[model samples]
Target: MDIAVTLEGLGQGFIYVVIGILFIWLVKKIDDWRTRDFDDDVHIDDGNIAVGLRRSGLYLGVAIALSGALGGSSKGFFLDLSHLLIDGFIITLFMFSSRFINDFIMLGNINNDQECVKSFVQPDGRKVVGNTAVGMVEAGMYVATGFILNGSISGSGGTFVQSIVSAILFFILGQLALLIVGFLYELITPFNVKNEIKSNNLAAGIGLGGILIALGIILMSSISGPFTGWANDLTSFGIYAVYGILMLLIFRIVIDKLLLPTTDIATEVKEDRNVAALIVVVSAINAVAIIIAFSM
Candidate 1:
């Protein structure tokens, strides 16, 4: 390998790093706008540390994931600046749009006031409380969205229009996966997920969030690679669906038997706000994600 070519690749990677930083800043602005009413005070307080950290993690994770995906398609480890900027813009658009979809699913229609925003407020006009559950759920959603977007564009050797269309298709597929996960959660749990999160049930929120991330990871493998046609895609989806279900079942059994033999996870999570149980579940989900990501 030529040293000059290697250096050029490194230089392009640095450019991506700079783009990631700028995108994170843009996300912060959007977050502020979304939660403006909650944090209306001019004086910034320290009450939202957890929320801030979660949001920061989300932005950075997405930026890195997307940049890495773009890097995979670059020529000889070097991306053209113009192409990098354009791809970055497209990714940023998809990221924000995905977040909007997540918000709508988790919190309902915010514009119609049929949401949970009011629950975060206090009579004194200060929303000082940081709901870690909601933050965790949102963070998981961001990771899921990033993975789906990344997988969609991972080896897409296509024109700009084709890439955009592929991204849109994968995004819709990702949303459908999320809906299925949500439905599964509802079937397994007795309590309502939105109500639990709105009431600050950290355990319930984390448990549901873990499932979302896990599904994203499982589907990521299926989404990557060349799109031969609709028939091939459908066949791939069927095979991956079986694999995902089996893997989830194994993880669930392992966590219950090995990780927490003395505890009933679902009951503990629903009734007691058991943070430890929730953490174990999230860890199990993420461990599977890591394994699958590496294998792919």
Candidate 2:
């Protein structure tokens, strides 16, 4: 048995675990700072689902970013840690940009941050504080950004300039793709996605969020691997993106029909507000995305 190799693996695992804990702590601090207008600690301790969802998304996105930076090369443990710290921090910032983009650009009609924290009253006069729908959208953005940022940090070859440029370019392109896909997703759905989400429909939120994260997973490979010049990479990335979008959209309809049969996905999401139906959509979409990402 290669005891030295095993020992090294164990040591690396231990270090990574420590780093993960630190990153989680950092995520919490960021959350507290972001929600400074409101007492996040109080809301969270009061069992606010909205706060929980937001925090979970941040944690999940950061974890994904860490994994991406973790990929490629073994330039010793210290070097790896440095790479992760630098790339991971940058990616974290990039992922958080989703909030601005979602609020002002993507879903301009919705104020996700405000909605998440505000309190409301249900029709039956029962008081509802947290808007889990906004939380779901935020969660999806975080996770999707994580996957896209993962692609940005991954790959090999190229000088430092080329790498930076590539990362920046891909990040821009990735956001654009997401914006377009999000628009198309809205078009394809029978119901008004934005309106539903605005009304705090958890089902619609999960439905839309599911597709965004799935697209992010599919696109990760388009920007991954060693740089082989801008033209080649751009063309490849563009082609792969188109394919991913078309296939994923098709899968959304086909899979929902095949699995649910009698149930209309549109009704389940828009009218019935069936979170379970959307969960099925998310699971199936992710399974297909993983397959397509690998096959590509």
Candidate 3:
């Protein structure tokens, strides 16, 4: 590669990082507004560091993913500055919308609740304040939405109208996939996920959140290339949906039967707040996601 091209790429990457930081700050402000009573600056008292960190992670991950997509689609290492900034803005809007959707699913409203800021009792009897578990789930949703949108935007290579339609279709498909995953999670557990997370069950939150991110990673692999037409697009989505279901089944079998044969993973999460077990489950799902991401 030309030295100038390399320098330009690095410069654009730095710009993305700066924009991402600013975006995170705006997200924090919006979160504070939505939550209404929490103060992010005071970490020791009413502040939920875990929530903040998780949100930051999601923002940063999405920024990086979007940047990578832009880099890949560019003619060389360097991105068109106009396109970079434009797409960055678009992605930022998508992230905000995605957050709203997550809140709708998890909180049942666009506004945050005290339940999300409630404290939980750990296995060691420590009183941990803030619903970090909910944060985990939110993070997963944000990251997944980012990946899906990023892939969709990158894949759109036609006229503006066509691209818009394709992006919308892909986004809808991604949301449906998330819903199916959530349903499957509910089936595996005997308790209500929202209630469990609202009760400050970190284990349950992390387990559920990890599965969402893992599913998103797998779904990202399937989102590539321009849409041929509605028929082809629907057919491709159906195939990916089947693949996602199969992957979920395999994930369940591996976690429940192969990895933790002696442990009832769902029961552990629902009843015991087994953070360690949740970690193991999350790790397993992420391992599969990594393998799938790399293979693609």
Candidate 4:
């Protein structure tokens, strides 16, 4: 039994490593594409491929360790990890794939001189990134919830159906919260607004935000349901949705009233307050979701 479990861990670890490598490759390709100018003559440095590999390896190691820790928690842990990895990987691939579509659909018509439009790409891109990240996280939660509902690690049709419904509902609510905060941020934060407007680096910032969103989703999803189950079992905690919403509202007010007021936006134009707000709110929501998921 011990040998089988160890072999399973190794197998799962290899799978995660492979998925991480693919993401690394996609990130590199996007970086290269973004840096290339309209003039094919412009030289582009791909940057340290070795360094990239090393960083990805580090992340992979962390993920593997996390998986091991989770698996050791119970018989259901391995099954949950499998679901999380599969769903997370699938959603991430889809999210990145959509970037290509967006690049073509949104920016296909502009001439080389108009390449400054790349900056516009970020504001929009961040939304996609944020949305995708949330989706992935929700997927992970549903996977765990499914196990809980069925009282087993093996997937079930009834549990899966309910989980899918729950995930969709939760995802929509999450996105709505993110979008509202993003809009508010645009209105209040001079720094965020200026960066959104006249800044020429929108797409780059959006890419970063999107990646972070994905990371947040993965982290949150991995533990919310089980944590909630544990908490409920121990303390009968409840009201998770309300707690998440309240946390978001509090954070939104703080960012809008305090941080935005400090920024001097007198000189900046057309800043994307929405994206900025979205960042703070999504981050808060992600954090709170984990808390509630575990607590209830």
Candidate 5:
């Protein structure tokens, strides 16, 4: 075994374990407080916001640690890690920032009491997003990091300048896909109506779905021909990434919308059954889609 690789793996694994524990703990804390503060309603306090950041940090750390552990030297770790961390931070920032601004601006027409800011759900069944602006921001970190890392935007071989260019191209293409989906979701929002609460679950779902699908599509698009010549490989990888993101986002939605308020704080609820089933079906469809895409 390569001693350097072994040591690096050990270090990364240690960091991952630490980050995972912190992540679970922070999520639990956020869930507990969210249950108490915004259980039936959605107005989360600023303190809950701090808990959100903790969760985000946990995710960022975990992603970097895991990425590092996967047969890479420490030389590129900081650069790759920084890219992962900053990208995660930026995504989270934009997600929550968009929510806050949208909510605040629409406050007059739509009752400010509706609590739109805190309705974001992190992957691990946490209600941090629905309690405070911070929760969404925190959750956004995870989503952003997940997208950037899973999209094949890192560790490509090139000179410093070339690598920088590749990274930017990767990020820009992903964001461009996101923009297209965002616009599409916004346009389709009028078609899906659930309640008088001014919240559109279908639209939200579509937006989340768009992110995953677009990420897959754009990653494949970015890898075509001379760009990377790895279109086939990335598409195969993207099949999994898209499925994972969808499953994660679906859980996030369920926690934010369904299970949390309905469950009693006295008892613990594991995965929501309906949401789990939905994820299974969606994942299956994504898998099938991937097979078909590759076959053609």
Candidate 6:
């Protein structure tokens, strides 16, 4: 390899890592400030499972979005750096917007952060902490949004304006897709998912949250890559989104049969609160999504 090319690649790689760390750090500060009333870091230090889970999702999600923003086709170091900063800011705003979306749209009845933030004491010197179930859902939403955001800005061979416009449109579609996924999930499942989650059913929350992330992985493939003509790209994304959703739905049933042949997933999740069983469901969903993403 040429010395200049090798050194330039090394420099780019180094800056990316540094920038990625800095973004994560900056977002954490912003997040902590945004919800100072809850103080996730403080509670996390105190072993608050809900805060821990919530924070975990946000961190991972931010990283995912950053990777997509900075790792795509490069126009040069300066251009890439400019895009990184711009996209990072946009992503930060979207991160907060995602919380609002999760609060109002995904689980309208539940104040998700409220559930994750507050704790209470019991009669016999016991503490009933914040709801891990709600935390899981919140976490899942962030993680899913991370993947969606990644796809939104990952396209290349286009102007910055084009990329921004594409991201905005694709992100809107992603939000809609997520909502549809939630609706379809509730529609097909035997028990009422929202009610189950409200009741602190960890299994139910895990199942829903895990599926959301899986769907995001599948969607990223459809939305990412070099941009072609507007009409062609839009059509491709629409077809892929529908196809991915349908396949996920089908896989839900398939996993139930093949992975958990003996266990009734609904009963386990709703009645027994079997988190282990739901974990199996999550793993299988993610596995299938990754397969579909790569196979395309």
TM per candidate comes to 0.81, 0.93, 0.83, 0.41, 0.43, 0.93
Which sections of candidate 6 miss by over 4 Å?
2-5, 120-127
TM-score of 3: 0.83
For model 2, what is the error of residue 186's alpha carbon versus the real structure, in angstroms, after optimal superposition?
Answer: 0.6
Q: Tens digits of per-residue lDDT for model 4 on 1-296?
A: 69998998788667656755664455446545654543211211233222232223223323432332233233364575566555444333333333332234222332222332122334456311112222222222222222222221122323544444433333333333333433443454434432332233332233223322333333233323432333342232124333443454455455345545654222212343344544554455455445644543
Ranking by TM-score: 6, 2, 3, 1, 5, 4
Candidate 4 lDDT for residue 221: 36
Report the lDDT tens digits of candidate 6 across residue range 1-296: 69999998998889988888888888899888878777687778888887788788988988998889976667888888989989988887887788788889888789876777566553245676777778898888899888988987988888899989888888788878988898998999998999887766778889888988988898888888998978988898788888888998889989998988888889888767888999988899999999999887
- After superposition on all C-alphas, the RMSD of every candidate to the true structure, in Å, is 4.1, 1.8, 3.2, 10.6, 10.8, 2.3
Per-residue error at 264 for model 6, in Å?
1.1
Model 1 Cα displacement at 27 (Å)? 1.9
Ranked by lDDT, the better of candidates 1 and 4 is 1
Model 4 ranges off by over 4 Å:
1-4, 19-90, 93-158, 164-169, 190-198, 201-223, 226-249, 252-296
Candidate 6 clashing pairs, residues 3+ apart or interchain: none
lDDT of 1 by residue, 1-296 (tens): 99998897688778777877777777677667866765522222554533653575468547745753564544543344565566666677766676676667654532211132323553346564555566667767777777777777674556656656777787787777776666666665666777776666668767877877787777777877776765676577657755775576557657766777777776777677788877877788778866865675
Please list the C-alpha lDDT of all candidates, in the order they appear: 0.65, 0.81, 0.68, 0.36, 0.39, 0.84
Measured on C-alpha atoms, candidate 2 has an lDDT of 0.81
The lowest-lDDT stretch of 10 consecutive residues in candidate 4 is 127-136
Pairs that clash in candidate 1: none
Candidate 6 worst ten-residue window by lDDT: 117-126
- Report the Cα lDDT for candidate 4: 0.36
Superposed by TM-score, candidate 2 places the C-alpha of residue 215 at a distance from the truth, in angstroms, of: 0.3
Of the candidates numbered 2 and 4, which has the greater TM-score value? 2
